[model samples]
Target: MTTQHLQNRVDPWGQLRTVASRGTRMGNRGILHNDANQVVRPWKHKRWVTCMLEFKQIKRPKPFSRGNYSELFFLDEATAFAAGHRPCGDCQKARHLDFKEKWLAANVDAQLRSAISMDDVDKVLHAERCVPGGGKTTFAATLGELPKGTMFEFAEAAFLVSAAGYLPWSFDGYGPAKRIDGATAVTVLTPASIVRAFEQGFVALVHASAGLDDPAAVASAQKNPS
Candidate 1:
């Protein structure tokens, strides 16, 4: 029998899967060691973080080795943000700074803007990512009101709302764009604060299927201006 590895792909909802694509980076909560290389615990702490694949010439750890954190992968930063993770300060300093700057500037309230720390942001994200029972926390919004890179649920499926259009999200990749001009209120899966960051012009890198390069699609998106 093949031994399952603890390394797995993480979706926007924080669910783990044994998909083929591991993306470009590795993420972790904390050390999750066991005999079977399975994620025995949901997470070790609230400080979930994403790190660069190569950092300070550090060597890759043995996959699912004893006394190491469970490895998680994401398609990109957008996917990581959607999954309620922040950039690692050590390995991803530039991204961490950028994220912090935007996160601070997006908060209009003086007290919140000035007093927040990475831990505080993680706390808020933790609450937004999971519910009391065991699912993601979601809110309702119209398609036009949501910014690009926001993920939402409609008709029992998840979609990534980009400038071009809504792209269906799956474990493999994003599907073709679907126009949502007639869409009413839908359940937004991305956390409210992160959505506000996108609204403030902090762009997240989306998958190629977002159709960001097509001129006609860009024009259509500009006309709609979501």
Candidate 2:
């Protein structure tokens, strides 16, 4: 019998999955290990974080080692951001600093702008991404209002908005682009603050399947309404 590894892949709704994929960061989903090299818990904490794959030549810990945090993976920074995680300060110092700089600049509130710590940013993100009852937080908005790299839920499916159109998200990869009316109201899955970051020129790396950067693909998508 094959033992199932811990559910670690983060979807657009911030739920955990066991799908396989390439991820740039190894995140923490709390301690889920047991003596038998199996996950005994799904998550033990709420402070989910995204860290650089390697740090300072440190020896890698055995995957899902006992007493260690469960390893979660994201397709890219965009996916990670959508899943309500921030860069790990220790391993991802440069990225964390960049994120903090953009996060503070995006805030309109003077008090928030004055703050220099990631804790404040995390607090705001926590509020926006999680509800009081322990579910993912979501907001309503029109497709046009959201910037590129933002993910949203519509028709009970998750999609990534891009220059081409709405790319359907799947566990394996993104599907073809589907055009939508700009004025149509949709449920945005990504946090509002992170959405602002996208608008402020902080781009999130999307999967190659998105094809947003491919002019031919974008033109084809425009020609074919799907």
Estimate the TM-score of every prediction: 0.84, 0.82
Candidate 1, residues 147-220, lDDT tens digits: the string is: 88888888888788877678888755578888777457998878888888888887776655565542222222
Give one clash count per candidate, in the order shown: 0, 0
Return the top candidate by TM-score.
1
Q: 26-50 in candidate 2: lDDT tens per residue? A: 6786776677655555456666688
- Which residue pairs show collisions in model 1? none
Candidate 2 C-alpha error for residue 163, in Å:
2.6
Worst 10 residues of 1 by lDDT: 217-226
Q: Worst ten-residue run, lDDT, model 2?
A: 217-226
Report the lDDT of model 2 for residue 202.
Answer: 76
- What lDDT score is found at residue 39 in candidate 1? 65
